[model samples]
Target: MPVSYIQGFDPQTLREIVDVRHCRERLDELGDQRSLPALLERVWLLKVTGDLDAALAVSEQSVRVARMGGPRKDLLRARVLHATVLQFRGAYAAAVQELTTCGEEAEGQGWAALAAFAYQHRGKVFYDAGDFVNARADFKRALFLRQEAGAPEPELQSTLAAIDAAERRRADVSVAG
Candidate 1:
């Protein structure tokens, strides 16, 4: 996962335009490792590099690996990450549906952190779709869940930033209208 926070995402796009060089560097460092963790990282790297097709393929492989060998929680996490790739590809409806299910399952299993992740990414999808109202609501839910999970300060800060971004965009739309 990228620990470096993305600053100054364009309000219009509601997504950080990742530097392909950085993602490529990470991919190079990842090498040919086929471990589940490596596969997941590759999925993220490919997604950020704007290789949505490759990302989706690797994401499917990740989910299959997790489902076959990992725990249920790991499977859910993989599914969330897969949904994020779908979100980035502009498959908004499919991404939202998958994320909604993941969020519900995580919450039902008392996994607040996982639930937060699901909700936060779903909020990003909503933001990308220009649905600021739903984005803000999901971001707020993610913030609460992160706090409940005792997430690290950086994680909490990320959610806070998301909420602020959504609010800013919402206000912009209202003013322009």
Candidate 2:
């Protein structure tokens, strides 16, 4: 895993988007010799900074590494992260496709938490695409699964709020129509 703190950076700065292209290029040059954790970290940082293109590149590379190393957990994570990057880039359908695949894989592996995360991200993509009904359902499923998986309280609360907001928006649309 990437260190939560980097030198010369405060806690908040740890997530600051820097030049991830350089890091990605270096990792690519190193090929299979590169560290998985480091690559994941760079991918995370790039995604956080809204550099979707670079993040996608790193995420795809991470998938390859995970497949080679036979780390199913890491592979699922990379797929979900890549989907999230696509969502942020406004590629809702593509993001949904990616998340759907991740969800299937997670379910197959009996990883409820990962599956829940995939559903949650996919729900957000639906919301972005204005598919409020599907979004609400997916978010609710995510909330249920996340709760059963004993995920953090903050995440649960946030998902709940999102569901509520989406529902309210949908209701308003119904009334207006």
Candidate 3:
């Protein structure tokens, strides 16, 4: 398959839908050190399939590639993905810091949707840290940005639902107290 045709699909989504042979074939066709999204997806595929070392290497390369300069939003996306990879490594604080910087940079760049992406991840990290309040706050910020950008909401809805559930949990705790 032509690399362009293969690139038309997200590798992560493609991996789920296709066999390992075809997926690996596509990855081989696409080659390593490709575009930001492809690198992110490759890293994600490795991460999902229990290839942490490869994922980490791809993620680090993705970060470097993003930093080397392309679109600001793409850089933000790579940074966010790198932060996510960090989370898998048990570097939660570093992940959050990277996410926070990405969010702020995206906000400054006027990339609302990218900022939302950063917020969503930051919220997940905060949740893992047992900081429900901060988690909800970050999720809300992400939700608001996604809405403002007129982005689709299937994923955002889940985040909002999570925030609502967190609020309910806090209220229940208060009542119990």
Error of 3 at 115 (Å): 0.3
Kindly list the per-residue Cα lDDT of model 3 for residues 72-144, writing each as its tens digit. Answer: 7777787888887777677889999999999999999888988988998887777666566887799899889
All candidates: CA RMSD (Å): 1.9, 6.1, 6.2
Rank list by lDDT:
1, 2, 3
Instruction: Tell me the whole-model lDDT of each prediction, alpha carbons only.
Output: 0.89, 0.74, 0.73
Stretches of candidate 2 off by over 4 Å are: 1-33
Q: Compared to the true structure, candidate 1 yields what TM-score?
A: 0.91
10 residues in a row with least lDDT, candidate 3:
7-16
- Give per-model TM-scores: 0.91, 0.76, 0.76
RMSD of 2: 6.1
Model 1 Cα lDDT, one tens digit per residue, 40-152: 98998898778899899999999999999999898998999999999988999999999999999999999999999999999999999999999999999999999999999
Candidate 2, residues 61-163: lDDT per residue as tens digits?
8778877885788888877877777877888889999899998888788788889889988887888787889888988988988988998886787678768
Error of 3 at 6 (Å): 19
